[model samples]
Target: MSGAVQAGYAPPTGPDQPTSGRRWVRWLVAATVLWAVLLAVLTWFSIRDDPPTVREQRSLAEAGPVTDRAVGELLAAAGDGGAARLLPDVLRTGCRITPMEDGAALTRGVEVLLPGDDARGLLQRVADRLPASWRAGVETTGDGPVLRADAGEFVAVEGHATGADRVRFTAATGCRPVGDGYRPLAGGGGPETDQATALLRAWGGPAGQVDHVAAACPGGATARTARAESAPAADRPSLADALAAARGGAVGVRATPEVYAWRAAGTSVVAERVDDRIRVTVTTGCDA
Candidate 1:
């Protein structure tokens, strides 16, 4: 007998394989295809379920920086009079832009006439359509939309209507209060009138004319405050300017808890620091 060693049944090392090996390869290939299919399904659903605002961000990002005119267009679209009767008697709209590190934040406010329950639904639709990035709970709020973004800062839109079905729509990039409360636009009844009435009453003064300092641009007796929205942050008005404005006339400066206030022409003008900017409020002794 020849002394020879015998080799066991060795598996094929190249592309060619035995029946059992081929079966194993087929199973692996099937498993991989299934995993890939499942992953694709998940991705599709995720994109499909994304909120409309997310898509808005993507589109706006591609379009570049937002402008005040762009913001006005949005507010005008949202304020379509046909959806609900805009209470011109009480309708008020305000737009302001605040400076930021990278760019500026533009905000617009519009007060409308709509029932509370109905307005919530309408504003929800508006919120869903907004391009501003929003907070988590904004999607589920009983009020309206509260949006925030790092590109500028927080932007909020809130709708409130009492049983009278009178709603105030306020949108802001900063923390300033919007439409302190609803008032009729007719009969000189509005934010400016109300502010003047409140301030004069607090000062225990008689009704008299009020005027803004010449240095205050976009100023009027009706506008309690004016912001230099067009200027850069560093170029904006400072606390000294506010103090100077309040002390321009026969008035004395006194530090109040919330502001530095003075009285002249039976009116009270107050100034205070809001973040890095200064806000000057001119309160006239107007009859409410």
Candidate 2:
């Protein structure tokens, strides 16, 4: 019989022909996936440390010197430190400081009574006192202009003058401004409390007369304002006399240099000289 060819039957040649196109495409896909995964891993590692950015570092650095200067100014104004004694009388009198001690922390704040209604001038004066490097600026808040030193040891010194001759100044030593002191949790006690009671007694303010007011203070401190009246001002002991008596009774007394004011525990007593009479205001939660 004669061999007849099939219509479309083709014999295979050697081994199967390689699928080059599909193989190349698979390899290319694998390589791309591998490269993407490698890139993602590298990116994650690069930022894993979470180091401070340039902006943050600059801010922190700028704040350090500014805060230090503010602290120095506060110390000088307070007149309690050895450095304060060296300062000129004019600079020292620009403000008065009251120091509060909490555990191992020692913090001081200032109270300024400016002469005129130049609230802006007062703010500018304080800003000028800082080193030129601080680049102090005044930002207007609801109350008044708040002097701010960005990235500093002392964050801000804020004050306001509603009118003329009624300026109130306060300084914030910490990174954040103190929001009317720590909120009082509840109750009150400690040797400080006892001292406060004794001081009030020395001032002739009956324990019954101590009225409580809502106050923001550490440990939920309750504010008390004790007023001694219905008697001649002369009959009442001056703030100095009361403080002396209190100190003699073994009460801790921290007095301003002028001797017209003193603080015991968290209580503050100020003797305001008006004409020939002196009015005494005994208040608790003073630094709170």
Q: State which candidate has the highest lDDT.
A: 2
Where model 1 places Cα greater than 4 Å from the true spot, the runs are 1-19, 50-225, 228-258, 261-269, 272-288
lDDT per residue (tens digit) for residues 1-288 in model 1:
955556785544665545777789999999999999999999788778864343222322221222222232223434332122112111223322234312222233333333233645555554555545432123434554343222232334444444333344444343222323222122233344445444433333332443221111111122122111111134333444434532566354445433455555434445444554334444332210
RMSD (CA, angstroms), candidate 2: 14.8
Per-prediction TM-score to the true structure, in the order listed = 0.27, 0.33
Please identify model 2 stretches exceeding 4 Å from their true place: 1-72, 75-109, 114-121, 137-146, 151-157, 162-199, 206-288
RMSD of 1: 16.2
